[model samples]
Target: MSASIPQDVFSAEWLALREELDARSRSHRLTGLAVDWLDKRSAGAPYGIVDLGCGSGSNLGFLASRLPGPQRWRLVDHDAQLLVHARRRGALLRDRAGSRVALETHCRSLSPMDRELLADADLVVASALFDLMSRSWVESLVAACAGHGQALLLTLSVDGDWAFLDRHGARVEESEDIAVRTLFQTHQHRDKGLGPALGGEGPAVLASILLAAGFWVESDATPWHLTAGDATQRGLAEALVTGWHDAAIEETPTQAARLGAWRDRRLADIDAGELGVTVGHRDLFAWPAERG
Candidate 1:
């Protein structure tokens, strides 16, 4: 695993892509899954929600829209700029529903140092952030959530696979794109960056973690397929695939030429509107150690 991943995975491009998608009124299916989780757990109680790693308020608005709970909401993230957006979302939520929802935010990257996160949240929530972490970090995070009796609801994790109509194109056995996943996965346990891979094993891995930590975890896989009309979806797909190929070449220059050709073909197809792109995502729900 590489020891140099930035705190925010993909840094600028991922955030930029998210903003563009947000402008298009994109709402991940995981948002509903999270609400469903709480609804079942409501068991006649008001539980708070702490959105861990809430970036750019993309999912926050979704949460506020669906789970209009009077309980506390703490939007936590290391990025101050992103938290600013979260605050704006809170205000918008207030304005739209005219409901006085309790809102608090903590600006800090994910780390063991943030004990307050574990100490306060009844639900430790994160979307699309688990796959970027390592095993050790995941363990610690899980333990903390368990310790706090906080339900962990992690959503939209990549399962080390992609699919389109043509499954052949999905697997890049002979391409540089193969190396990109390896490099990113390498960062999981490398520890200097995004920590270990909490989720490369996909939904099953998360289920195991939550179960072992004493939470009865339930999961619903959401196929986050993207077609041509969604420009941001198309752009993100292109970036991830191309970035993987580029990383592979960075490590092994021997396949540089062929990898370049593969990317050109794929990108060419995408540009020509000859290919279809589809992404798969899954959401996981688990209760606090005590609750289960």
Candidate 2:
């Protein structure tokens, strides 16, 4: 993994693990609006889209066939290896009209807010990325998009809500779980190569900024509800438990023993097929108010 990749979450393993879940969890309604917004643009040329943090091109894979045809995509990420995966997968994408999509990749950091990157884009799209960005970065991005009259679609931004649930769909809470959660949330705000990350607050903050910028924004819940009975989701649940435990320990080393116990219990529950995990996320689609 490149040093610039935040939290090591952009690795091919992690991207592959979450890709299907992300596709299933994203709000189709919001995506439909984005497609409609893009369709309304002048039809003489292909639509230009830029996917920030384009991990393995999962965003492109999900949105390509859903959006209108003759599309050009610029996949941006700091990890060159991931960019290679993105480009390979992106080459196989076709738009709604069954036309081959134009694709390019840029391996660079997103900090410092590159205005020129958005200069030619008709739409700016990102998935599972905003939570790692500070408020200022988001504000800068929205301002640039607004200046260019570009549409924006962002998906799977963590809303800072999650829970371990019983097979009956009831919440399973413990005191240590709450403590661990608080610590993990705090850890989320730590600088992830993007100054202070917004973490779960990212979606709401971005929505507010878009609204303030005279954009008509539509948003919906896109939470991941994973079951222990399914093998893949069970694995993801285990990973979440391990990740949360590690993050909580990083935030409060004094509680390492307690958090470790909590992690063990969570893994045990998963192994016994007694619990599931629900991670909250939100998807937003915004366009210039004039278009509304």
**TM-score, every prediction:** 0.77, 0.96
Q: lDDT tens digits, residues 5-25, model 1?
A: 224353544765644433233
Stretches of candidate 1 off by over 4 Å are 1-13, 16-47, 94-98, 163-192, 228-232, 289-292
Specify the highest-TM-score model's number: 2
lDDT of 2: 0.86
Clashing pairs in 1: 1-186, 78-108, 78-109, 133-196, 133-197, 134-195, 134-196, 134-197, 188-196
Give the Å shift of residue 255 in candidate 1: 2.5
lDDT winner among the candidates?
2
List lDDT for all candidates, in order: 0.60, 0.86
TM-score of decoy 1 = 0.77
Residue 56 of model 2 has an lDDT of 87
